[model samples]
Target: MSCKYIYSHVVRLLNESDTICIEFEDAMFGRPKSIRLLREDIVRFMEIREIGARQILVYMGHLYKELKKKDKADYFSFLDPGNIPTCPIGTDDRDLSQHIADQLEAVCRDSICLIPYNTGYHWILTIVNEDKNMIHLLNSTSNRNRDDTWKTIVTNGVKMYNASKGISKGPGFKILTGNLKQSGSVECGYCVMRYMKEIVDCDDPQLEKMFAGCIKNQYYTQCQYDEVRSEWSEFVYSYVGA
Candidate 1:
């Protein structure tokens, strides 16, 4: 369906005062997940506002379901931002490592894991490729320092996953900071979502090329942002109905 048609349905729902809820079965987790978006949450898409984790989570869940339906989700998995352990390397790093490793264990070898990491103030994407043993950090903003903590956590998690599979080598980490920057601070979440969609939509061989082809100091166009917003609106309408 066209984005306009889908967005119109969502706008109509927002006009009503009642709570809007979307419930769908999550094939990856073997359970039903319900997402409730209040009117304010829905408004985030309509306006140029900072999207909450709930909105990202909803979109991720929807994307996972859509991919699974088409049998394209076998080589992909998504980690919830809230489930990722925070920084500072606390005393529970081992437990946290194990928790993250457990999640990666479900992912098959030679697969891509999309993670929307929250750096307290902004959202960025961390793409883990087990095939190449590489972690590509895609941030919409120019803040390389903010990614240090997440890089450590995810690298450790990947190490643990390798250990569990009897592999002794660690993964290589690279921070890609040139292109795909958001124009403003509030667009981080939206950019991350669009990045995920782009990566998932690409073929395996084209993945490396896509990252390597990123131009320096480039920003996402308004059309790209609108595309994400449209997709989000369409997903909500498809699941929630009019």
Candidate 2:
């Protein structure tokens, strides 16, 4: 988890993964001018590898934070465990374990948390709003009903936290609705990063407007998604270069 290790790993991944390299290039310098460009051509040259560079960008603290203008204590960002060796979210057959409970407690300690959530195939964000005692699901697909498992996880975690603190009464957790949502199927990760920006910017009125617009659109576009990713990628590149 050291910065040096993360920096080196990200650089290697970007250079080795062709699709991500192209995406990083596109984000840094717009699309190629040549009309002859095609997916086949990129595939032939791409150094095919697993796509975890972006995840590394997210977990390694490469993303920038403008601390001069905002309170650092308000937001807590943690990278979620999604791959092998990590236990799956609890289900009827499986109960919530101590390790997962500890993770939840850490997230809930912050006023707002930005953590990744995996749905076996796709990735999404689960935002914990400690102030409101609510868990907001910023899903890209506009599927509200899909957050039941997460809700259970948060609820159980809160209970365990209160017990550990020896508090008989405490604020309970609830799922927040009607917040900003992603527009595309694959844009959830991007939306999560953007949410991190919104939390730090502290522009209440503008944030409200942004959420209202997303609610009206029912979903945003890949363009918006790419824009957020571009910002984060820039931060990652700068950190690596530095």
Candidate 3:
């Protein structure tokens, strides 16, 4: 399918939700950037399929705006997708745990939970299958030394699950870390969105197609990444300034 066709279809689906009503606008500064599918744009793309993802971004954006009004230093953290908290494994941070649980409970009515995390420089995604008692991690770059983050998410997931559903001891979810294809360093963010896309596009909750599709094909070069970033940067500047 043509890029225009896919984007139009996505926009149609997103508009149906009554929560999203995005429009295409040309950039006024530097050079006009073309709208194309890039790793960076997939969150907006996947948001078309998953209302929870869009709601998360909207809530985070609103939180940042409120914090910014209060002159908070960490306000920008809520705006960036690559700003996952780096609390180590077994950290006893109840506020953070409760906040995560609240975020999940607000959107996640089903058993599955989708999480997007960033380690300052790279982006990774986590999918918790509550029914299957499994946690799968999708990292576009190296998957080494991720045990801490994985464990931290799992630990918090248990807390969130319990709080959201009034459960006692949570089921132990098996952790599975895997690799996704990346064409450039900055593509981690895009890879994270693609991970979400694959999961949403699947027919089965096991997401067999997502696992196979990600491993087989998914990549964006430096130039493509740059174009996407520029386009988004310009759009944000215009939208926020307006």
What TM-score do all the candidates reach, one by one? 0.84, 0.59, 0.51
Question: Which 10 consecutive positions of candidate 1 have the poorest summed lDDT?
Answer: 85-94
Candidate with the greatest TM-score versus the true structure: 1
Q: Rate the local accuracy (lDDT) of all candidates.
A: 0.73, 0.45, 0.45
Per-residue error for 84 in candidate 1, Å, reads: 2.2
Q: What is the number of backbone collisions in each predicted candidate, taken in the order shown?
A: 0, 2, 1
Task: Give lDDT tens digits, candidate 2, residues 1-242.
Answer: 23334334544554442322212222111222111212232222122212232442332243324432245533444434432122344562124434444655544443455556555555555555554344555555656554666556655555565567675554454333345565444455555556666555564423333444345465545565555544544444444433
Which wins on lDDT, candidate 1 or candidate 2? 1
Model 3, which residues run further than 4 Å from truth? Answer: 1-92, 130-132, 174-179, 208-242
Which regions of candidate 2 deviate over 4 angstroms? Answer: 1-64, 67-97, 104-110, 170-177, 203-216, 239-242
Tell me the lDDT of model 3 at 149. Answer: 53
Model 1 stretches astray by more than 4 angstroms? 1-17, 30-32, 88-92, 107-110
lDDT of 1: 0.73
Which 10 residues in a row give candidate 3 its minimum summed lDDT? 25-34
Ranking by TM-score: 1, 2, 3
lDDT of 3: 0.45
